[model samples]
Target: MVSAWETWVRRLVTRRPGVPAPAVAEATDPAGTRLVGAPEPVSRLLVVRPDTVALLTAAGTDPQLRRPGDLLVPPLLSPGAPPVTARAVSTAAVDLDVTVTDLLTFDGHAVDRAVLGVLVQLDDRDWYAELLELAAGHADDLEEYLLAAVHRELTTAVRGAVRMNRLADLQRLTLAAVLQDRWLPARLGAGTLRCLRTRVQRVRWPGEDEPTVPVRPPPAPAAPEPPPQPTGPDQSVPAGST
Candidate 1:
């Protein structure tokens, strides 16, 4: 019987209006476990027996799907399979939904339950019971697995926090630049300063403590000298000392 995951992939292929079905490749780790690869343009599906489903990414470089312990296992599974469940973990965009078909094709039927549980938790959906069951089944490695899971959680959280901080910093810088550009001092002079007329009332200067000296305009030019006072007819002003 075709696995539920496989069935989902077929449905996805039909639903997409113009996109063509992706090519499937078989990926084998040194240990010889086989996983189906859903290459770019095609979503990969992973089938965990009984009741787990996951979609693996098919874009850009394929993501490695393995648990911490997998490192100890010779020939780690590469491009292992879709996680039964996955969380956004960290994303630069809005929430993204992984289609059932995509999940089934990314990894085909060789995922560890513990890893799947981590995915489910990250997904933050209604798979708590399944997550518990997976955890219960792997009691031996429960502690270690949980630790790794928490590490992934913290890693994602830190990345998100950093991104948020950077965004806030950019916003603040933009506001400061805009304000400085719009409100910079227009002119400065000895004891007097001028700003845009709109901001005249709002301008503040450093030496407000010192009284402002009233600016006096130069005395108007002395009324043009009355044509030489007709002194000649009145009192003869001696050119030489009289």
Candidate 2:
């Protein structure tokens, strides 16, 4: 196999204004800059926006590094440029669709039909740490990482509630009632993702246009079984004599 990374010096990747402002973004096209601080030979550099932080895996020694005001010597990790992870201090809204199922009952209820709409906010403070935890030392992709975690949390909460109660209760239950005080402030690893808005978007029951079919009305009540019963006994005996 052939290698493409030529390790000679360090580089920087900065988030300029007016670009796609994702909370955490990969620095694919890093901009080259003068060695900011220590003469550490890094494969690449990521200079994030104000109030934003970048995780430079292939650079400087101090683990408690904050910014480039003090550029120290960077370690030389040679083969290729390690991908830089940077996140601006901001919040992002993520919408999740979680399937609510009746776990305790074998009611043949749909496992996929009923869904709860979960609107969560990934704030500036917590998202990065949570991302790092979920990444588990792997490459970083914020959207992919976040949604997976959220979906898991939502499913757990919903199913837990469903197990205690019937699906019928869920049909009438409102997402707002559960979300604000109950499901909000979810702690996933070190990340804090809160439920911003939620709703029970779908249920397995019939819709307005397709309501419960009415029973056939007991065949119109048999047309008044009236006073004929009073004389019917004698009338039948007389017929036999004739």
Candidate 3:
């Protein structure tokens, strides 16, 4: 079973000698760049490394990748074009989609609920709830399933909050998402700072104490105009006079 993946990796390495290899090969080619530093290679098998999974995700969608049996490879860059550099990409920025057929092709790695959920959440894609339920029932790593669900909720809330311009909600959602990251629990608190900074910067607020407009006393109510004295024949005579 393992031999199949090793064979595929070797084929990919041979197919594109200088192209960035996606996974750490069990055997290294003297000519190829190391896998750890370059673009992640896609595979018919599930990739367990979260970072590698993330890199493949950042590549957006390729029509070839969506085909059931198509071998995954790094995108061929245009002449003088640069490859993507962002680590954590927002799905909104890309026009990518994954079909259920493509997803079910994961073979033994199909139980990776985290990767599955990512396929669903990114680019507003959704899997039938029954599909996820089925996956969860058989998933080898239940923790990854739950974590994926958490991240999906976070992305949904964050996007919704941003759309509505709800800063407080956005802050709450971002903090909740950060807390879900077990690797850096401190980021939960720090995440708030980042959220506030981003919000202020996004709206172009220059200072913490800056007012929306110059504060000044409101104009006093104008004194009521004095009643007009009688004019001509309409003038009232002196009280004692006729």
TM-score (all chains, Cα) for each model: 0.17, 0.45, 0.17
Where is model 2 more than 4 Å wrong at Cα?
1-47, 50-53, 59-90, 95-111, 123-136, 174-185, 188-192, 206-242
Clash statistics: count for each candidate:
16, 10, 2
Candidates ranked, most accurate by lDDT first: 2, 3, 1
Worst 10 residues of 2 by lDDT: 6-15
After superposing candidate 3, which stretches have Cα over 4 Å from the reference? Answer: 1-136, 166-242
Who is ahead in lDDT, 2 or 3? 2
Select the stronger candidate by TM-score from 1 and 2.
2
Clashing pairs in 3: 22-40, 22-41
Per-residue C-alpha lDDT of model 2 across residues 85-148, encoded as one tens digit per residue: 2333224444455555443422434333446665555444543455445434422333333444
Tens-digit lDDT string for candidate 3 (172-238): 4552343233322221111210111111111211123424786799999999999998677657687
Worst 10 residues of 3 by lDDT: 94-103
Residues 23-104, candidate 1, lDDT per residue (tens digit)? 1222222311111212222233422221112222322333323321121121124356332221111101111111111111
**Whole-model Cα lDDT of every candidate shown, in order:** 0.26, 0.41, 0.28
| Candidate 2: RMSD to truth | 20.0
Model 1 segments more than 4 A misplaced: 1-128, 167-242
The TM-score that candidate 1 achieves is 0.17
